[model samples]
Target: MAWRNALTKSMQELRIHLCQTSPASAGVRDFVMANYAEIKKVDPRFPVSLRECAGAEAKLTARYDFGVEKTVSVQGASSAAVLTQLQELIQLGEKMPKSGE
Candidate 1:
Protein backbone atom coordinates (compact mmCIF):
# COMPACT_ATOMS: atom_id res chain seq x y z
CA MET A 1 0.00 0.00 0.00
CA ALA A 2 2.75 2.40 0.88
CA TRP A 3 4.69 1.63 -2.27
CA ARG A 4 1.54 2.08 -4.32
CA ASN A 5 0.96 5.50 -2.85
CA ALA A 6 4.55 6.46 -3.46
CA LEU A 7 4.29 5.40 -7.06
CA THR A 8 1.17 7.44 -7.61
CA LYS A 9 2.75 10.45 -6.03
CA SER A 10 5.83 10.04 -8.15
CA MET A 11 3.85 9.92 -11.37
CA GLN A 12 1.84 12.96 -10.41
CA GLU A 13 4.95 14.89 -9.55
CA LEU A 14 6.64 13.93 -12.78
CA ARG A 15 3.66 15.07 -14.81
CA ILE A 16 3.49 18.33 -12.96
CA HIS A 17 7.19 18.98 -13.44
CA LEU A 18 7.01 18.26 -17.13
CA CYS A 19 4.10 20.60 -17.66
CA GLN A 20 5.59 23.46 -15.71
CA THR A 21 6.82 25.28 -18.84
CA SER A 22 9.21 25.59 -21.74
CA PRO A 23 12.59 23.90 -21.30
CA ALA A 24 11.29 21.31 -18.87
CA SER A 25 8.48 20.32 -21.15
CA ALA A 26 10.87 20.19 -24.08
CA GLY A 27 13.34 18.03 -22.19
CA VAL A 28 10.63 15.68 -21.04
CA ARG A 29 9.21 15.40 -24.53
CA ASP A 30 12.59 14.65 -26.01
CA PHE A 31 13.47 12.04 -23.43
CA VAL A 32 10.13 10.31 -23.72
CA MET A 33 10.07 10.38 -27.50
CA ALA A 34 13.60 9.07 -27.77
CA ASN A 35 12.87 6.27 -25.37
CA TYR A 36 9.33 5.65 -26.54
CA ALA A 37 10.28 2.67 -28.61
CA GLU A 38 11.91 1.06 -25.61
CA ILE A 39 8.90 1.88 -23.51
CA LYS A 40 6.59 0.34 -26.07
CA LYS A 41 8.78 -2.71 -26.19
CA VAL A 42 7.80 -3.24 -22.60
CA ASP A 43 4.03 -3.07 -23.14
CA PRO A 44 3.58 -2.34 -26.82
CA ARG A 45 1.21 0.41 -25.74
CA PHE A 46 3.00 2.61 -23.28
CA PRO A 47 1.73 6.12 -22.81
CA VAL A 48 3.49 7.97 -25.62
CA SER A 49 2.76 11.61 -25.20
CA LEU A 50 3.64 14.10 -22.51
CA ARG A 51 2.07 17.43 -23.27
CA GLU A 52 1.66 20.67 -21.44
CA CYS A 53 -1.78 21.47 -20.13
CA ALA A 54 -3.57 24.47 -18.71
CA GLY A 55 -2.23 26.00 -15.50
CA ALA A 56 0.84 23.88 -14.93
CA GLU A 57 -0.81 20.51 -15.35
CA ALA A 58 0.56 17.96 -17.76
CA LYS A 59 -1.30 15.42 -19.87
CA LEU A 60 -0.16 11.98 -20.78
CA THR A 61 -1.88 10.48 -23.74
CA ALA A 62 -1.91 6.98 -25.11
CA ARG A 63 -3.17 5.98 -28.50
CA TYR A 64 -4.84 2.72 -29.36
CA ASP A 65 -2.61 1.42 -32.12
CA PHE A 66 -5.12 -1.19 -33.17
CA GLY A 67 -7.23 0.95 -35.47
CA VAL A 68 -9.09 2.83 -32.75
CA GLU A 69 -8.56 6.58 -33.12
CA LYS A 70 -9.52 7.59 -29.61
CA THR A 71 -7.01 8.97 -27.12
CA VAL A 72 -6.61 7.54 -23.64
CA SER A 73 -5.36 8.84 -20.31
CA VAL A 74 -2.08 7.39 -19.21
CA GLN A 75 -1.83 8.92 -15.79
CA GLY A 76 -3.15 7.82 -12.38
CA ALA A 77 -3.89 4.11 -12.14
CA SER A 78 -2.69 3.37 -15.66
CA SER A 79 0.67 5.02 -15.09
CA ALA A 80 1.19 3.06 -11.92
CA ALA A 81 0.58 -0.24 -13.63
CA VAL A 82 2.87 0.22 -16.62
CA LEU A 83 5.58 2.13 -14.79
CA THR A 84 5.74 -0.55 -12.15
CA GLN A 85 6.18 -3.17 -14.82
CA LEU A 86 8.91 -1.09 -16.41
CA GLN A 87 10.76 -0.56 -13.14
CA GLU A 88 10.65 -4.28 -12.53
CA LEU A 89 12.04 -4.96 -15.97
CA ILE A 90 14.86 -2.53 -15.35
CA GLN A 91 15.73 -4.00 -12.00
CA LEU A 92 15.88 -7.42 -13.57
CA GLY A 93 18.38 -6.20 -16.16
CA GLU A 94 16.11 -6.94 -19.07
CA LYS A 95 17.19 -5.69 -22.47
CA MET A 96 15.05 -4.87 -25.46
CA PRO A 97 16.49 -5.53 -28.86
CA LYS A 98 17.48 -2.67 -31.09
CA SER A 99 15.17 -1.53 -33.83
CA GLY A 100 15.48 -3.25 -37.22
CA GLU A 101 16.26 -6.58 -35.66
Candidate 2:
Protein backbone atom coordinates (compact mmCIF):
# COMPACT_ATOMS: atom_id res chain seq x y z
CA MET A 1 0.00 0.00 0.00
CA ALA A 2 3.01 2.32 0.00
CA TRP A 3 2.29 3.56 -3.51
CA ARG A 4 -1.27 2.52 -4.00
CA ASN A 5 -1.90 5.18 -6.61
CA ALA A 6 0.14 3.21 -9.13
CA LEU A 7 -2.50 0.53 -9.20
CA THR A 8 -4.96 2.95 -10.77
CA LYS A 9 -2.59 3.92 -13.52
CA SER A 10 -0.13 1.89 -15.59
CA MET A 11 0.46 -1.03 -13.25
CA GLN A 12 -1.29 -3.78 -15.14
CA GLU A 13 -0.43 -6.77 -13.05
CA LEU A 14 1.67 -7.86 -10.10
CA ARG A 15 2.79 -11.44 -10.28
CA ILE A 16 4.67 -13.31 -7.60
CA HIS A 17 6.30 -16.55 -8.60
CA LEU A 18 7.72 -18.74 -5.89
CA CYS A 19 8.21 -22.29 -4.82
CA GLN A 20 5.74 -23.65 -2.34
CA THR A 21 8.38 -25.08 -0.04
CA SER A 22 11.73 -23.76 -1.15
CA PRO A 23 13.88 -22.03 1.41
CA ALA A 24 14.65 -19.26 -1.08
CA SER A 25 10.95 -18.42 -1.27
CA ALA A 26 10.43 -18.11 2.44
CA GLY A 27 10.52 -14.35 2.51
CA VAL A 28 8.15 -13.99 -0.41
CA ARG A 29 5.80 -16.47 1.15
CA ASP A 30 5.84 -14.55 4.37
CA PHE A 31 5.24 -11.32 2.54
CA VAL A 32 2.24 -12.69 0.68
CA MET A 33 0.78 -14.06 3.84
CA ALA A 34 1.07 -10.82 5.74
CA ASN A 35 0.50 -8.07 3.18
CA TYR A 36 -1.21 -9.44 0.10
CA ALA A 37 -4.64 -8.70 1.50
CA GLU A 38 -3.72 -5.17 2.35
CA ILE A 39 -2.30 -4.61 -1.10
CA LYS A 40 -5.53 -5.66 -2.74
CA LYS A 41 -7.51 -3.60 -0.32
CA VAL A 42 -5.60 -0.50 -1.33
CA ASP A 43 -6.65 -0.95 -4.94
CA PRO A 44 -9.51 -3.35 -5.41
CA ARG A 45 -9.16 -3.31 -9.18
CA PHE A 46 -5.46 -4.12 -9.26
CA PRO A 47 -4.51 -7.58 -10.34
CA VAL A 48 -2.26 -9.51 -7.99
CA SER A 49 -1.44 -13.04 -8.92
CA LEU A 50 0.47 -15.70 -7.01
CA ARG A 51 2.06 -18.72 -8.59
CA GLU A 52 3.55 -21.50 -6.53
CA CYS A 53 5.51 -24.43 -7.80
CA ALA A 54 7.80 -27.03 -6.28
CA GLY A 55 11.02 -25.72 -7.81
CA ALA A 56 10.09 -22.32 -9.15
CA GLU A 57 12.41 -19.37 -8.60
CA ALA A 58 11.23 -16.60 -6.34
CA LYS A 59 10.60 -13.49 -8.37
CA LEU A 60 8.28 -10.51 -8.56
CA THR A 61 7.04 -9.27 -11.91
CA ALA A 62 5.30 -5.98 -12.45
CA ARG A 63 3.64 -5.65 -15.80
CA TYR A 64 2.80 -2.32 -17.31
CA ASP A 65 1.22 -1.22 -20.58
CA PHE A 66 2.87 -1.55 -24.03
CA GLY A 67 4.15 -5.00 -23.09
CA VAL A 68 6.61 -3.46 -20.65
CA GLU A 69 7.49 -5.41 -17.58
CA LYS A 70 9.88 -5.06 -14.65
CA THR A 71 11.06 -8.11 -12.82
CA VAL A 72 13.21 -8.53 -9.72
CA SER A 73 14.59 -11.61 -8.08
CA VAL A 74 13.30 -12.05 -4.60
CA GLN A 75 15.19 -15.20 -3.89
CA GLY A 76 16.21 -15.25 -0.24
CA ALA A 77 15.02 -11.64 0.17
CA SER A 78 13.41 -10.32 3.29
CA SER A 79 9.75 -9.35 3.30
CA ALA A 80 10.78 -5.74 3.88
CA ALA A 81 13.09 -5.89 0.90
CA VAL A 82 10.32 -7.14 -1.32
CA LEU A 83 8.05 -4.37 -0.13
CA THR A 84 10.75 -1.81 -0.93
CA GLN A 85 11.13 -3.17 -4.43
CA LEU A 86 7.39 -2.99 -4.97
CA GLN A 87 7.33 0.60 -3.78
CA GLU A 88 10.06 1.41 -6.26
CA LEU A 89 8.05 -0.16 -9.04
CA ILE A 90 5.02 1.87 -8.06
CA GLN A 91 7.08 5.03 -8.26
CA LEU A 92 8.26 3.96 -11.67
CA GLY A 93 4.67 3.42 -12.74
CA GLU A 94 3.87 7.02 -11.96
CA LYS A 95 6.44 8.21 -14.49
CA MET A 96 5.93 5.57 -17.20
CA PRO A 97 2.84 6.53 -19.12
CA LYS A 98 0.70 4.02 -20.91
CA SER A 99 0.54 3.72 -24.67
CA GLY A 100 -1.36 6.57 -26.35
CA GLU A 101 -1.73 8.32 -23.04
Candidate 3:
Protein backbone atom coordinates (compact mmCIF):
# COMPACT_ATOMS: atom_id res chain seq x y z
CA MET A 1 0.00 0.00 0.00
CA ALA A 2 2.81 2.37 0.81
CA TRP A 3 4.49 1.52 -2.47
CA ARG A 4 1.24 2.07 -4.30
CA ASN A 5 0.85 5.45 -2.69
CA ALA A 6 4.34 6.42 -3.71
CA LEU A 7 3.77 5.21 -7.24
CA THR A 8 0.56 7.16 -7.52
CA LYS A 9 2.24 10.29 -6.28
CA SER A 10 5.07 9.84 -8.71
CA MET A 11 2.68 9.33 -11.58
CA GLN A 12 0.68 12.37 -10.61
CA GLU A 13 3.80 14.47 -10.47
CA LEU A 14 4.90 13.26 -13.86
CA ARG A 15 1.54 14.08 -15.38
CA ILE A 16 1.55 17.53 -13.87
CA HIS A 17 5.03 18.18 -15.14
CA LEU A 18 4.13 17.01 -18.60
CA CYS A 19 0.96 19.02 -18.67
CA GLN A 20 2.83 22.09 -17.54
CA THR A 21 5.76 21.63 -19.86
CA SER A 22 4.08 20.59 -23.08
CA PRO A 23 2.33 23.86 -23.95
CA ALA A 24 5.30 26.03 -23.19
CA SER A 25 7.47 23.76 -25.22
CA ALA A 26 4.94 23.86 -28.00
CA GLY A 27 4.79 27.65 -27.93
CA VAL A 28 8.52 27.86 -28.21
CA ARG A 29 8.31 25.58 -31.16
CA ASP A 30 5.58 27.67 -32.76
CA PHE A 31 7.56 30.84 -32.27
CA VAL A 32 10.54 29.31 -33.95
CA MET A 33 8.45 28.09 -36.82
CA ALA A 34 6.74 31.43 -37.22
CA ASN A 35 10.09 33.12 -37.29
CA TYR A 36 11.63 30.63 -39.62
CA ALA A 37 12.09 33.23 -42.34
CA GLU A 38 14.23 35.43 -40.13
CA ILE A 39 16.01 32.41 -38.79
CA LYS A 40 16.64 31.01 -42.25
CA LYS A 41 18.20 34.26 -43.42
CA VAL A 42 20.91 33.64 -40.88
CA ASP A 43 21.37 30.14 -42.22
CA PRO A 44 19.72 29.34 -45.48
CA ARG A 45 19.61 25.64 -44.88
CA PHE A 46 18.25 25.74 -41.39
CA PRO A 47 15.82 22.93 -40.71
CA VAL A 48 12.56 24.51 -39.61
CA SER A 49 10.49 21.64 -38.45
CA LEU A 50 8.62 21.31 -35.17
CA ARG A 51 9.47 17.61 -34.92
CA GLU A 52 13.11 18.57 -34.98
CA CYS A 53 12.52 20.92 -32.09
CA ALA A 54 10.37 18.60 -30.02
CA GLY A 55 12.29 16.49 -27.54
CA ALA A 56 12.20 15.01 -24.07
CA GLU A 57 11.66 18.43 -22.54
CA ALA A 58 12.34 21.27 -24.96
CA LYS A 59 15.09 21.19 -27.55
CA LEU A 60 15.72 22.76 -30.95
CA THR A 61 17.95 21.58 -33.75
CA ALA A 62 19.00 23.68 -36.71
CA ARG A 63 20.98 22.37 -39.60
CA TYR A 64 22.82 25.16 -41.30
CA ASP A 65 24.21 24.95 -44.79
CA PHE A 66 26.86 27.62 -44.86
CA GLY A 67 29.65 25.67 -46.47
CA VAL A 68 31.52 23.68 -43.82
CA GLU A 69 28.81 24.61 -41.37
CA LYS A 70 27.47 22.18 -38.80
CA THR A 71 24.21 21.49 -37.11
CA VAL A 72 23.28 23.97 -34.39
CA SER A 73 21.13 22.96 -31.47
CA VAL A 74 19.34 25.12 -28.93
CA GLN A 75 17.09 24.19 -26.04
CA GLY A 76 14.61 26.38 -24.20
CA ALA A 77 11.32 26.20 -22.37
CA SER A 78 8.01 27.91 -23.24
CA SER A 79 6.85 31.36 -22.20
CA ALA A 80 5.16 32.24 -18.92
CA ALA A 81 1.63 32.24 -20.30
CA VAL A 82 1.90 28.70 -21.56
CA LEU A 83 3.44 27.46 -18.35
CA THR A 84 0.71 29.13 -16.31
CA GLN A 85 -2.12 27.55 -18.29
CA LEU A 86 -0.51 24.17 -18.19
CA GLN A 87 -0.05 24.35 -14.45
CA GLU A 88 -3.70 25.31 -14.06
CA LEU A 89 -4.85 22.35 -16.16
CA ILE A 90 -2.66 19.97 -14.23
CA GLN A 91 -4.08 21.20 -10.93
CA LEU A 92 -7.58 20.75 -12.27
CA GLY A 93 -6.80 17.23 -13.39
CA GLU A 94 -5.36 16.40 -10.00
CA LYS A 95 -8.60 17.42 -8.34
CA MET A 96 -10.63 15.04 -10.47
CA PRO A 97 -10.83 11.38 -9.56
CA LYS A 98 -10.15 8.65 -12.06
CA SER A 99 -13.07 7.00 -13.79
CA GLY A 100 -14.79 4.02 -12.19
CA GLU A 101 -13.86 5.30 -8.72
Measured against the true structure, the TM-scores of the candidates, in listed sequence, are 0.31, 0.87, 0.29
Per-residue accuracy of model 1 over 1-101 as CA lDDT, tens digit each: 23333222222112212444444245444545555565445445323344456444233332222322222222322334434543443322223332233
lDDT digits (tens) for residues 28-72 of candidate 2: 999899987887787887889999999999998999887789998
- Which RMSD values do the candidates have, in order? 12.1, 1.7, 18.8
List candidate 3 stretches off by more than 4 Å: 1-21, 47-49, 52-56, 61-76, 79-101
Q: What value does the lDDT take at residue 64 in candidate 1? A: 22
Candidate 1's C-alpha runs over 4 A off are 1-17, 45-51, 54-101
Assess each prediction's global lDDT (C-alpha) against the native: 0.36, 0.84, 0.36
Please name the candidate that would achieve the greatest lDDT relative to the true structure: 2
Clashing pairs in 1: none
Please give, for residues 1-101, the per-residue lDDT of candidate 3 as tens digits: 13222223212222111122455456555544454466446445433344432234553222211221122222344444433443444344445554435
Clash count in backbone of candidate 3: 0
Colliding pairs, model 2:
none
Ranking by lDDT: 2, 3, 1
